[model samples]
Target: MPQSKPQESPARKLLNILLLVVGTVTFLGFSFGPLFQALGPSESPEASLVTEQLRAQADGYRAVLEREPDNPIALRGLIDTQLQLNEPQGAIEPLKKLVELEPENRQLRAFLAQIQQDTGDLEGALEQLQILHEKDPKDSQVLQELADVQLALGRPSQAIELLENYLKEVPEDNDVRLRLAFIYVRNNQTEKAVALYDEMIAADPSDFAPVLGKAIALSSATDENLRAKAPELFEQAARLAPPKLREQIRQEAELSAQRNQPQAVESQETAP
Candidate 1:
């Protein structure tokens, strides 16, 4: 009996199956993406917990201060939170209260000084350090820290004096010597700086800091005579330094040589 109905195309059926598979994949992705994100591994659970706890404690202290604003403990707690959070500016008010309540607390005073230093309030920090130094004149740590802060405040002369006085008691202190060299450099006494570096190198020739410092200082000298000495210092530093720094020192020496040639030519031209 007559021709049978043409069979439905297999291509149409395959296309329908492909559409169904894609639709299912889209549905699954949309549903699971946020679920996986919510359950992802956290990068800093401990810090997050500490921050949350501090916030809660801060809020509690704030509420207490709202009711009894003069409470010294509440003020101290708020100051501690601010310090932990690295918001030293925010700590100033509570610290002022703590200082008023406990003027004799040297630890509190030192903490205030440190926070002030961290916040760039060097004058305030210096005042606090002076008071602390008066209380404990023999504290080398305090002296060193104060000297460093003074240097940061553009008082390298004071830093040098402090380091000198500290070295009188703690002689053989290489750390103090290093700090003194830094102060000398800051004061533009490159000769003194180089001398200190030389002393340090004589004591421990293997130490790279002094050698590098000497090389750098010699490379920056203004006098052509002095500038001629830089390549030797750089070669010495290159030998003593690690591979990475050795390459850098060699490059600097080459550049310094290039710079010196022009100056030498200029001087020769000016000669009679």
Candidate 2:
């Protein structure tokens, strides 16, 4: 008998929404590439009316919540109002109540985690994401967020291990693989970073990410031979890059060539 696939969790569904609302930006050192656009708060009240109107809305929601503590609508309204008022701390208790109202709701849990992250409560965020990861190890969005929290906590080795283990199960996930390579470069494992980029390039020669990633990895290498090859690869990557990115990669290539030129001249002048 064929088994049915599980429905997407609310937590995963809100990755784009809640992560943005909290302003959690993920950056890979050299940026293999942007995976998604910057998503954030929905249309907000104008600056002039923000304080007066939003604060009144927040108070209304609070009054309702005081009468009916488990009211999801009031809880959500309060959260939205507080967030719009730029008072994330004020949103926390209401968010906690919402999570308690539906302990099985992954979306609420994920939202709480993001709010915690935004509030600089990284350990709290990590604890929430850890539970999500344990419940769904193959949830790529959860895995990525978990790894991001690990990175935010200054645990690159742990982030690398988390991504690496997930990659073993889903080897074709280029996004995760690129993230892993970025970590390797950041951790000073340039050889490993270069190797991973080579693998990605071999898989798709026309893709500019690994090409640019390899160029970046090589450009930072201690090996002169490796560094010497960076400018040429950068140029190759520029040719393969999208029209929007082409100019930036071209400028990078030019800068790399200029930087290497003085070293090349020094080597030539000193040679017998």
Highest TM-score: which candidate?
2
Please provide, for model 2 over 159-254, each residue's C-alpha lDDT reduced to its tens digit, 9 standing for 90 to 100.
999999999899999877776776687678988888998999999999878888788777766788998998888788778866666776676666
Tell me the tens digit of each residue's lDDT in model 1 across 1-272: 01122333333222222222112212111100111011123459887787777779888888999999789878978876765654568787778678778888876776677667656687887898788887887776567667767766777788898888877887787656665665576577888978887898999998666765666666666777777787787788778766655675576668667766764434345667
Q: How many angstroms is residue 201 displaced in model 1 relative to the true structure, after the best TM-score fit?
A: 1.6
TM-score of each: 0.61, 0.75
Task: Point to the candidate with the largest lDDT.
Answer: 2
Regions of candidate 2 where Cα sits further than 4 Å from its true position: 1-46, 254-272
Per-candidate clash tally = 0, 0
Number of backbone clashes in candidate 1 = 0
lDDT scores in order: 0.65, 0.70
Q: Any idea what lDDT model 2 has?
A: 0.70
